[model samples]
Target: MPDIREENKDIINCVLESMQGFVVTDLDGKIIFLNDRYADILQVDRHEVIGKDVIDVIPGTRMHIVARTGREEMGSLFKLKNGESVLVNRIPVRKNGKIIGVAAFGSLSMLDEMSTVATIQKIGHLSQELNQYKSELNKLRGAKYSLDQIIGNSPNLIKMKELIKKVAQTKSTVLITGETGTGKELVAHAIHQLSTRSHHSFGRLNCAAIPNDLLESELFGYEEGAFTGAKKGGKIGKFELANCGTLLLDEINQMPLYFQSKLLRVIQEKEIERVGGNKPIDIDVRLIFTTNRNLLDMVHQDSFREDLYYRINVMSIEVPPLRTRVDDIPFLVEHFISKINKELGLNITGIDDKVIELFQTYYWPGNIREMENTIERAANLALQGKLTLELFEHFLLRKEKERSRNENEICLETVRFKAEKETIIRVLAQTNANVSMAAKLLKINRSVLYEKIKKYDIRTM
Candidate 1:
């Protein structure tokens, strides 16, 4: 029952509502009509400037210039005063041969959201590019962790450095043994840096962290469609990735016996076969293996292979834990503080001598890593140029108690081996169940500690 003209008007209004950023002007550059969407983009009311000069209504407008020329300025991009830019198409309206007006249309808003999406996609692409080049950068720099970065001046540390310098130029397979956090991985990098292969890539794999079934494929790579969800176009393995370079296999003892034979083949043959493919790919890689556990103990228990042990142990380095190198505490403290000064913009001159003395007294079971983090924490909270005992006292108490409690628990009862076993227990307690610390305090190798614990049926709990 609606009138035809009314229906047509309704349809036109509905279309205009959806036509975002639409405008109309006459030949003299006077505004005739403006849509609500266009007014929102211009940040003005649609009804307020119907008869105003288009240039006066919107500053920096070129529609008036186009009207004067009676020429089209199509596909022009315009920037707004509010820091938003839009793509616009300008068309000249004409009656017969005479030019009438100019019209323009484009996306004039929603630029902020669009720009943000574009930026995130660009960042993702850049991240992929950075990851692709990271290995080459590490090789060109010689080592990710250099000998200079180790941060200690103890005789024991100095001796370890000399050993590293001696073996770095040789082609012997190296086995780096140390307790957790003793910078064994850093030593690995230092070796690679001084090696003849320093110009090539450096690759690393952690045996303990990877799943047993996936470890082989990860090291040797696989062909496309080799298994479910295999990457398209195949993948390169770590050995291939480190061709003519150094490959660090960390937690070497954690590699399963099943895969140990396969690893031995790679070392002896200097070649690898892909997980799904049998073609042997030759490689020229220098091998460096690291273990926190005693591989000899694992071999004795039949968990690790003896032949593989002898092969990797062609050269070995056992870094003494920080507790055994108390003489280097001051140097380590200063080194860490100086490094933190650069990172945090702190000017911590030094810790008080009292704090340094306490630092030496406490058993650093976590070694240099623990010390670095502690210094970093204290530096973050420092008020002046010095770290006082007030801050040191809080961190020192728990470790100090461990030392005192072990000293107090002297088995007054004499039972020879039983008493010796009980003393070992006391040391273990004092060191807070850390095998490396207990061994250091008992003046024995960590392998010896494990053997005695097994012999005495000593429960660490």
Candidate 2:
């Protein structure tokens, strides 16, 4: 007798895995095979259910009946235990004209599939739009920035740079964290520029910018006909494009938890399967993840995966916020002024010492990005001259006003004295300078009231 199960098991397994969700059962209707997607669809662990009866493992399933009757059930609406319905197709396996087993392929709800198709179309359109920059990106590939371009000399910054140099020589994944606009992305670029993969492309994706539905496709790519409106010939994802190079995933905290599990698998396996692809493609890209949020806090809250947190955190670089490293403001200011001067076709030779002092003292809530904008806006207004507080009088002067207000703030003692002095004067006038009566009304001793009057230099009526 021909044994189809053993004769082509490898080929069958490959085809089954490429499917979205699938389950295979033996002649007795006991589950013999299943894939991750199927387990995900059923919300159960694949390991726990293998060797179990299909009917018990999956609610409203007809795999056993199909296996015994050698019949095929197509386009069946299967209701899960959770009351959700999915479309599935079950077919009996055959060998030498005899029934052997049954395999069922399932898909997500029709509503979900429609939404996925819409998202694919939207991404396809965006991919088309981005194609215009493909040539420019190729020309500038791996030309982002070097370590010298970081432009800071604070002890914290020097230590971070030294760490970057040491980190660039390794192949370990790097985690970069800091407040938003703290130049974390620059550090990522610097690391990539100094690494051995500098000769290859450096790719970046902003996790916060991409929709959750589109993140997997954008990162792992997809094959043609992966969905209803998928792009023709498919589109390559960042992992493949940056193979043998570096990929920076910025704002990584925005990634959803479900997708974090998927990402964890990719990191561990060092390979990826396209959305509709059957074979896994090997990747050699180094990864650098940057985020403004605290991932450890997120892990504690269960918003981020704990395993992924520890995995990517093998090495970390915490970029110091601008407020903590205000010593760099002068150098940062000079650099931005010179850069903006050429861009604006102006000759801003220097900045006033007072203005620099204001910058150093001012809390840079927006960090380096805000500083650059401040200089650019002032540079635009000046056209050609030494940058001054007057140029930034509109916005930067608010800091000076805040400082003056703070300086002129009243202390508790002064407030108490003023209230007491005014109240004593009013009470004395009400009593026609009757010290005893005024003291009684004021709820204090006559001698104390008289002494307070003398101290405040008040003349009673």
Candidate 3:
């Protein structure tokens, strides 16, 4: 009988050694035995793991249903601290039908899998293939649009382009003011791409999107246990992620007044203090801000900080609305059509002359974004060859009626006269209020220019 018991013990030990992962815990959940394979899976020594509470070594074990119920459990997925995924099986260890303890046999791999090396190699190969496919897809998408992609023949646009290029070469803070959908974000990206820090990170945040309460933490990371439900380890914020690079604050006007002081301090001191943290960390970052709202109005209303506004408006660039740059409509239309074709896989070639004429005549209240959407819809519905006027009649006619109503509501002739007045004022200011130079720049006779300037209430600075 003694020889039989020794043989049984030897067989049990052999079975545990040959198994992938085996752990024997007492009824109280103290790990009394651990096989070599079990220690290898956790990357720990088997002797050290023995006699320790299973919950202490593997906290996930405490949540196992088998710990509550004495019945056997199988094929449970377990996650480790190191981000490893494993499969486990827990069975009740009984003697003479009396439950003594629990024995867990787990395999990191799925059922019918052999070794971890084979599973890891398979996952690595799949990841490589997926990345290759994504690269190919992105290449096929081609270049969509950027600041450099905007084409125009107007002198105003040319000067604006030059200013953008010059500012792109510097690290100075830039403020871009424009109406909604006027491509302020695009200009910001162009500046970052052209700067010396182009190789580094380019981060963007919409001041309007984040809540005021969370904005501080989002901009400056918090330490572990900084607040309730905080992450176990600390998290890095966008500002820190963009250190040594560029950070674009889109819709800067929407930033809360309370946070304006914090932003100004970071800009002035080049340092930031994380939320709930005492220490200050220095950062090297170029700041760019964009807003569609009239910041001067906000400053007057005390909705925005005057000092912060001036600090960020060191180099202001105002993007003209599409209405003011009507001459660029043809180029913009063609670009949108091509973009739509590539994105939606449509082969639209050209628009009819009548449609182009109607497009030029219509006033685009929503600017370039509206035009792009119209073109995309037309392209999706049009036949393969050419886009006809009838295909865009609904959108075109609607815009034309709107334009007519606007002209009637605000006396078209009077508005044009006022526009001419403003143009003269701007041209004279640019030419130092010299009539001869302003006339030459405006391509008009000096006498006629003087008569028009006097006819309207145009004043020179």
Candidate 2 C-alpha RMSD relative to the actual structure = 23.4
lDDT (10s digit) by residue, model 2, range 351-440: 888878878887676788978888888888888879888898766576667666655665656888999999988988888999999988
Q: What would the per-residue lDDT of candidate 1 be over residues 1-461, giving only the tens digit for each residue?
A: 87999999999887766775667789888888888877877789889989899888777788876776566766455655465656666777889978888887664443458674475456556757876787668746346877788777778888999999999978889999999988899999999887768767889999999999999889999988889989998899989988988999999989999999999999899899997897999999999999999998888668999899999999999989989999988988888888898887888888889888888887787888988888887788884589987776558776777777666655443346787898988999998889998988888778878888998999987
Show where candidate 2 strays beyond 4 Å: 1-138, 397-461
Candidate ordering by TM-score (highest first): 1, 3, 2
Each candidate's clash count: 0, 0, 0
What TM-score does candidate 2 reach?
0.58
**Candidate 3: clashing residue pairs, number:** 0
TM-score of each: 0.60, 0.58, 0.58
Better of 1 and 2 by TM-score: 1
Cα lDDT for residue 348, model 1? 87
What are the root-mean-square deviations of the candidates from the true structure over C-alphas? 24.4, 23.4, 20.3
Say which prediction, candidate 1 or candidate 3, comes out ahead on lDDT: 1
**Weakest 10 consecutive residues, lDDT, candidate 2?**
108-117
